[model samples]
Target: MGSTRIAVVVASTGRPEELGRWKEHILRQTLQPSRFVFAVVKPSDLPSSDAMLPCAEVVYCNPGLPVQRNAALELLLGATHIIAFFDDDYVPSAYCLEGIVDFFQRHSAVVAVNGSLLADGINTAGIPYEEAIALVDANDRNGKPEAKVICSLDGLYGCNMVYRSAAIGAERFDENLPLYAWQEDIDFAARVGRRGGLALTTAFAGVHQGVKAARLAGVRLGYSQIANPVYLMRKGTLSFKAGIRLIARNLVMNHVRAFKPEPWIDRRGRCKGNWIGILDLVIGRDHPKNILSIRQ
Candidate 1:
């Protein structure tokens, strides 16, 4: 805890505007990250110019969340005490980083901590950036209690999770789980959790803007919905019960909602993809990256 160097790693593509909006909040954290790494598919994924350019490092990688994440992990391993992953559109309270630092310092056995969310926009039409920031700012002003609510969890949520670098050692994300890398967090956490403890806590918190831009095609996401969990379950990173549950939930939502889909979601495309996934499941042809080959 004495020399805890925290570094932030963000993976994104086609959302340079999101990075610009997220940058100010990251810099204003009460305990700033020792290093700021933005892993992207190309130079364009970042703003053309930024006042914080000198303080941040940009690493380009193949287009995928897991690929970019692993790139940052490789770069930050020896230099960082903790590595934090925040989605590009997320808005964290000013105390977010400081709260996490305190949480880990107090709970030495915890391998990773998934922060509580003030509000998550992923379930609906994406939250506007300004609205997300306002929600975060209001929560910050209300005061954050020191009293902690912690519980053991089988996995960490990807949007805003922090991990102890030492605990991570040589581990890496599954690069094959391309693009948004659905369920990648659960797979990563489920394995690392066995080495120590995994926790869900209120000490750290943020808002998930869930900007819908740069998302993978609905059919692709739909395909991963079924294939990835089956793959992970076989890989032993996901339990059979959990895998089945994920597969059922996604399939049902896609089908039921296809009739009256949200303007923000591609429920119809997802439904078709779900059928393709089921056929692949029976024929032994599905893979998470299979989505990459499927045409929109």
Candidate 2:
């Protein structure tokens, strides 16, 4: 696949530094994209050309991960054969784009592919750029050899996934899913999976650089933890049992971890939010949109 055949879409909000780091990584890719589209919630926050790595078309969209991504998709219409979405905070390997194009070329039946994370943990935002690269290098040294492909994943990781344009026609990310759109990628990828196949690959890779400081307020994320899964279950994207498992795991972890909070996580705040969500659910008010109405 030629560089002209792929387009890269990045959805970002208020995290200029991380986005810059990601842009540098993308600009250094072995296989460059035909176009780079950066979507930000506030148009004013879009980086000027002088600060950008290359000529990227910056777009303004409402503040939601899925909504921003869909905005990028609109601009990319008919522009490329493949569309790849990367979180603004992730630092993908140099061969990431090359691996994506290669896999799609080799597997005509596959609609999407998720790149593996070099690190076991997600919070790499505070690490220096040089150290972050070193960490990925360290992981690669001790990590298992890269696999050509892994079969049968339910969906793509939102952080690093690529899709064939033809397979994704008319399908857009669920806008109803609010900020961060927790699990929106899973819902969208499951739709793609139903049309064809979905797989993950070690050959394609990235580091999440979670960017805890840029994350949603602890309470918002906490509420989403419980409310979002239930919402997905209600929408048929997640089974009831699966939703229960997700909620239970989060509730338990938040409760337990609050006692021994990790520096990278706001465990107590999340736990408080979890209980608030549960209380809301019990009172027949578990909808996610209700979050905006609540006073923090």
Candidate 3:
């Protein structure tokens, strides 16, 4: 990547303290980013006054993953050669940025790369911030194993995805998915990578705390579990088979777990939302944005 610069973007809400706690990771990166942008819904979404991070830019936007990210994107379009998006709770290895530059330099065919994850808490209760940092630190200390491209991917994972800014040109995250914008990454990556390729890479790795805070309402997320995939399938970003599997997997899990929902999850609410979404589909309304209309 030579003189070309890499910029980082983070779209976060209600995680001011988390960002404050993790800001030092920016200083630890082996190759610093030329730009670090944060997209927030409100002023308080940033770090507290006493704990402010230096050399970072903030952009305000309505509260939705796509909209926030797109807001940040506007600032970096022609200013950078590469752009990486990290979730607020993600802790990347010290050489993460170096790995990203290396991976891109070596793989000209890949348009986007999803960093490998040492641990992801989204599937379970969620990893503690300290635990996530410990994992990242251990990786940094023991040996920053050489980063390598791992596998092909249909969509870059949202927690830690990197792309060549030139490849992105006018592409943006889809705002129609709204709020948490479930599967929005798939939609965006599919569109952006149509000219090239998408891949998973070990050139960089991170721990995703998947902190439960600031998530969308259960009804909206559950509704997205159904409607979002269908919407993507119709738009041709998601295959019919893949979309059906996603919908079925969520519906089955919600059904089976509704009787004994995890403490961290709202299985009953999600199940109700799933049913509501299905009914809407039956009535010729399968739009993903419809979740916004479902009152709490």
Candidate 4:
């Protein structure tokens, strides 16, 4: 098996306490990564030192998910063969990296692998793994032995996915997707797949501590879920039918039912606005905005 140098990129905006927990989980991993990099958005917000963890590198960058991811990607580029993306709220299983390395080694054609996201069962703050599983698309079920499955265009969620550094090349998360909430992963995955890469989902998992979505300028940003997919679809990421299905599913199943009535109405309105944005994207009306600008 090839010696795959793994770089775990933890992108965060705030929550030093959660970072500490994540750090603990990383340090205890059975298959240690070559390097562990925590890319924090606002450095001043994090603890001055997480000295407990060895070989830990922390980077602070402008407060955007794409920008933070790009910063981590740049730092990790030449240093590792496989780069795994993990969010700040996640605490990975001890075997997460080991499973990734083994999967990649055994499945040479796989360009990316996604892990299951379990909710912390103890807290009212987090969604339980069972609940999270209920949220997955029925068609995108995981198979044994890391076999390739037909994933929907919207299948690649960012919370726990690994990418081949070489296949990614200089391509980074779309900077124009200013809102960190939604379709960036779908867009990135589509780009990778279109370029002859495959993304796989595995039973191996990680735990999300159930943090609320980050706020932008005191208001919780919902653009990614509301707008980004529409933008992505207009950009030709998904077929017309797939795009309609995604929007319908979000509107009927995920958004309206899950959110409060008032916020749901407001978010629905925003989603409507994105239809126009989608048209604009297609007809060349407004250029896409930078992802960093949307972060508070």
In order, the Cα lDDT scores of the candidates are: 0.87, 0.79, 0.88, 0.63
Model 1 misplacement above 4 A? 51-53
Q: After superposition, how far is residue 110 of candidate 1 from its true place, in Å?
A: 0.6
lDDT of 4 by residue, 1-296 (tens): 24779888887776665566555667656678888888876665464475335677888787677888888898999889999887766666666777788777766776776775544432244664344435432312432224333353334667777888887886788877764545677777777765454654453566665666453422123334435555677788756787677656655643454355443134544444445445555666533452234333
Clashes of each: 0, 0, 2, 2
lDDT of 4 at 235: 84
Candidate 3: clashing residue pairs, number? 2
- True lDDT of residue 81, candidate 3: 92
> Between candidates 2 and 3, which one is better according to TM-score?
3
Q: After superposition, how far is residue 190 of candidate 3 from its true place, in Å?
A: 0.8
Model 2, C-alpha of 103: deviation from truth (Å): 0.3
> Residue 252's C-alpha lDDT in candidate 2?
93
TM-score of every prediction relative to native: 0.96, 0.91, 0.97, 0.75
Q: Cα miss at 163, model 3 (Å)?
A: 0.7
Kindly report which residue pairs in candidate 1 clash with one another.
Answer: none
C-alpha lDDT of residue 160 in model 4:
79
Per-residue alpha-carbon lDDT of candidate 1 for residues 158-258, written as tens digits (9 for 90 to 100): 99989999989778999889888999999999878878999988887889987898898899889899899999999999989989998999999888889
